[model samples]
Target: MKKVVAISIFLIVGLASVQAQKTAKMEFKSETIDYGDIKKGSDGLRVFEVKNVGDAPLIIEDVKSSCGCTVPTKPEEPILPGETGKIEVKYDTNRVGPIRKTVTVYSNSSEPVKALKIKGTVIDRESGS
Candidate 1:
């Protein structure tokens, strides 16, 4: 009886692992983007490129910014296996000074939720000090 139970457990675990192997995966070109130094109110936009490196389709459900100053947008359609997608991030450069923000991406990929980073410095033109 013990042997039978062990076999059943092993079979279940094996099936689960097989299913996980077919799930969608997200592979980003770079997890972090550095804008370096920029003048206030300058173009504060960047794109995070990712690839669907799994056997299934990658569906990005939502993209949330850490604060109001930063905005993130995800692709409208699902990313098929071996395909690529982009996440556009727009930071408000109006607020001068150091910038460090995070964007959380929710998807159906292996990593259901992932955090992306953006950091840089914004200098005010008026302050010219």
Candidate 2:
């Protein structure tokens, strides 16, 4: 009687709470961006494509680069479910050497923190190699 009624109410509430909780999922087209080989002082901009596959809005909290030579920019607005966003990374092309940097992304997705990699080589214009 009373026990059965209380059990039923509890189950209903639990189910409703579960249904109200929505999560956001982040999916990247590719986790790594390869700059390839290019001459020094060339274009150093690249974009990382991200998609929100879950039912909730994806909010990017912050984006940090591993070094000062690398700059990463995150989207300002929230990405709704089933939508796409972009993170732009710019490396210092003036530096002649190998390009190996890590960019960390913080967001309200299932995986809150993600690490992206950029790799390539920068050739010296004077050397032409």
Candidate 3:
């Protein structure tokens, strides 16, 4: 009886592992977005394109920015396998200076969590400083 129980448990565990192998995969068109040099108060919105490369639906759980100056938005709906989605990020262009930020993404993709980056400078053309 003990031998049968152990075998049953082993089979169940193996089946669970097999099921776990099928999951969503997130593939980004580019890991970084460059805002380049822009004038103050210019449009700060940018998008990061992503694709679901795995067999399952890609569900983005959360999107966060490293600093309050930057805001990141994730897709509200699931991205089906082979479909594409967009993650929008907006940086406060009012702050005049070099811009460097990180956006973290949490999702059901196989990778679970991913970090994206943005870089560039915000220039105040009117104020020489």
Candidate 4:
């Protein structure tokens, strides 16, 4: 009975460790962005901060936007452990009304793909009275 109990506890701890290892070590400050409100025909900028919290280095391969109206920029080099990086997002408000965009990031860490989202409402300019 004692041996069985010890074996069970070992298995449980091992499983927990494995599960934690499978989880992505990379993290982001804010996964989503809310522009809140803006005027039409305007442009906006946002920066997403990322940090490496795992033992391995964090390498961002690329960043892609959902549409041409949105642009994304990121660091060119790899971020060492406990280092920081940035993802710059630009939105062009040509069309009016609410807007939701996504920026996909590819990396060389445990979680190779990371997604960042942005949402906001655009108010059209009032016409001359």
Q: Relative to the true structure, how large is the alpha-carbon lDDT of every model? A: 0.94, 0.95, 0.95, 0.84
lDDT of 1 by residue, 28-49 (tens): 9999999888899899999999
Candidate 1 wrongly placed segments (more than 4 Å): 1-21, 127-129
| lDDT (10s digit) by residue, model 3, range 1-129 | 999999999999999999889899999999999998988999999999999999999999999999999999899999999999999999999999999899999999889999999999999979743
Which residue pairs overlap in candidate 4's backbone?
none
Cα deviation of 60, candidate 1, in Å? 0.4
Task: Residues 41-117, candidate 4: write the lDDT tens digits.
Answer: 76688899999887767878899999997899988987888888899999987767787989999987788898899
TM-scores for every candidate against the unseen true structure: 0.83, 0.89, 0.85, 0.75
Ranking by lDDT: 3, 2, 1, 4
Q: Please state the error at residue 5 of candidate 1 in Å.
A: 21
The weakest ten consecutive residues by lDDT in model 3 span 120-129
Best by TM-score: 2
Which candidate would rank higher by lDDT, 1 or 4?
1
Residue-pair clashes per candidate, as listed?
0, 0, 0, 0
Candidate 2 structure quality by residue, lDDT tens digits, 13-119? 99999977888999999999998897898999999999999999999999999999999999999999999999999999999889999999999998999999999
Q: What is the lDDT of residue 20 in candidate 1?
A: 75
Candidate 3 residue runs with Cα over 4 Å from true position: 1-18, 127-129
